[model samples]
Target: MDTMTYDYTEPVLSPKGQKMRDILADYITVVSHRLPDDVTKKLVELSKIEVDPLQRLIYDTMMENQMLAGKLKRPSCQDTGALQFFIKCGAKFPLLSELNAILKDAVYRATKQAPLRHNAVQTFDEFNTGMNIGDGIPSVFMQIVDDSADIEMYVYMAGGGCTLPGEAKVLMPGEGYEGVVRFVMDRMTSYGINACPPLLVGVGVGTSAETAALNSKLALMRRVDSVSPNKNAAKLEHLLEDGINHIGLGPQGFGGKASVMGVNVINTARHPSAIGVGVSTGCWSHRRGKINFDSDLNYDLPLNEGVEL
Candidate 1:
């Protein structure tokens, strides 16, 4: 997805645009060092369910890591990860023309301010940019909203381990939705341990592999306690959660009672002949944040509490 290129002239930013950039940069910094409220809450819930001594210690260590990261104002993990911005912006928004430059600049500044690990490397050529900005680094996906002035953004740190098992495949018509479950379970059993279990699993079902893959990542933006709106998808989420936790990969994959925080499934109408399924996992850290803003640059951090930027 990062291979695609775009040609557009950059624009100068006004005061509002500049403010937006600073806000996003700081938001990224905070997200890197702090866990989102939902993720923190889920971890607390999981930590309480473990019985094994080693597994309980692992959970304790996870909490200590977060505490230290917060106190030191440093990234919670060494792999600060590839920055991904999923933006839903209004076409009529005042800074529309400068959004791209604003986001890129925010990423650049956040890299230095957060002291984020330089994770962006040129593909194939094998060279690190050392600044997390490259031809297509810090992936940005945007969707335009028609007649409104509100923009919603989701920032995600797609760490290597979390994304390693991400896969999408189109199943034959005969394979049915059961194929989707099998695909997720298969991937989880194979690599769930590596991703820091008590993982949040995202599954996508759609008409093609690419669509499913995108939807799968989007699924991770949902709250850990929320179920899919669609009845069938919600059922699948619960079933996948149960099946995964039953695997007993436990905290940090050391074997315990809980293997996952939750399972999220997002779907769209599929082509008559195909069922596409994709899987992505977020490690226990689950570093993702949501913020909403107006054209005036006024914003709210819904996933964060008692924080102002």
Candidate 2:
């Protein structure tokens, strides 16, 4: 059988644009190998809390996995997942026009350099793109900031297992915030195990299902130990974290003292008639990174300390 290749034309970029693309590609590869600082810290904290022999063993193995992955400069998980970028770009940024093309090219480069799994399949076409650059494969969600010349981005690898538990729904207004809690708890009990337990749960509350879903994903980009700024939302974060931990899914769903590293809540105002809630989870691997760049292309990676790209 002849090997099939998806045709994707590379965009011609300016010198600066090419530089940015290469930097992003290197960043992606680094993100693939090393868990972010917050995630690593949380895992270590959780490991000490588990007493069951098998549970402790699982945590030990997880630590070993990270050490080996970093030492060998290889991906920690076989499933590298589809790449997603949540970007906050300034209106005055120099590369704004070329940002999209640069990002797509960067993913293509990372696919080869990281040896990431062939996860981008065309819908209805039923074949892998091979390059990991298919129609909207590296999903980019951007928010524009006025009067600045810098950009901040969150790069996430949304693997299948972690994404399996994601869901959103709109509840009647009368159901109240308590209803949001009920909805999240229900999902956590039913499907959180499949996401590889000791998960990082993200809850989004907004005006509609779509808004809530987007907020839920944004929630996942936050630091594992961070709490919501809104006082009520912060309270709810603790509430949901305690509620999910009570499930006792433990390390890899094997049953133990803790089922979650943390729960983050991101909320926006909603209409009077309805309440929308969405839930998303990050597995124990939790491969996500944050990078910031100035107009001159100087960059800083706050999530993975000591990583140079």
Candidate 3:
């Protein structure tokens, strides 16, 4: 793949646009250090369920690590991962014209200010960009809406352990949805623990492999407490969660009662001839956050309510 061909445009920002970039830098810093509310709450719940003495100790250490990261203002993990942004914005957004530039600068500034580990290495050259900006770095996926002025953004760090190489396949018409379950089980049992277990599994079912792969990652942006709104999808979520947890991968894959915080499935109507299924996982640390901005750029960090910046 020629990463240079990725359509990431850079534009000069106005004074107001510069300010938005600064705010986004701050948002990245906060997200990098603080676990989002839903993820934190789920971690607490899982900690209580863990009965193994070693696993209980592991949870305690995990909480301590999170607390110290926030208190000291540092990344929760050394890897810090690759920056990925999922954005849904109105075409009328105040910053729509400058959104891409702002996001790119946000990553650059966050890399320096947050002191995030430089993880963007030139694929063929194997040379680190050091600034966290390079060809295709800080990937931004956008969905444009009309007749509104709000923007919703999801920020995720594709850590070394999490963001595992996802699996996707198109099942034949006769295979049926049961094949989807079987595929997920195969992947989860084989590699889910390797992603630093107590994972959040995101499964996507759609008409084709590409759509399934995209939806799988998007599902990771949802609140950990949320289940699929679709009845069958919700049931699959429960069954997958139950089945994976029964494997005893536990916190950090050290072995315990719970292997995953939750399993979420996002689906679209598939073609009559095929069912495409994909799976992705988030590690226990789960460094992801969601925020909403109004026309004026005044933002609401629903996942970080008490966070001022």
Tens-place lDDT digits, model 2, residues 1-309: 655668989999999999999999999999998999999999999999988799999999999999999899889899898999999988999999999999999999999998788899988777899988899989999999777999999999999999999999999999999999999999999999999878999999999999999999999999999989999999999999988998889999999999998999999999989899999999999999999999999999999888777
**lDDT for predicted candidate 1 compared with the true structure:** 0.89
Cα RMSDs, all models: 3.5, 1.2, 3.1
Count of backbone collisions within predicted model 2:
0
Per-candidate TM vs. native?
0.95, 0.98, 0.95
Candidate 3 residue-wise lDDT at 288: 92
lDDT of 1 by residue, 1-309 (tens): 344433334346788888999999999999999999999999988888777789889989999999999999999999898999888988788887888789888888899999899888878767677778787777989899677888999999999998887999999989898889999999999988889778999999999999999999999998999999999999999999999999989988788998998999999899999999999999998899998998788899999998777
lDDT of 2 at 48: 96
Candidate 3 — which pairs collide?
Answer: none
lDDT ranking from best to worst?
2, 1, 3
Better of 1 and 2 by lDDT: 2
Off by over 4 Å in 2: 1-5
Candidate 1 residue 127 Cα shift, in angstroms, is: 0.4
Mark the 10 consecutive residues where model 3 has the least summed lDDT. 1-10
Models sorted by TM-score, best on top: 2, 1, 3
Residue clash pairs of candidate 1? none
Return whichever of 1 and 3 wins on lDDT. Answer: 1
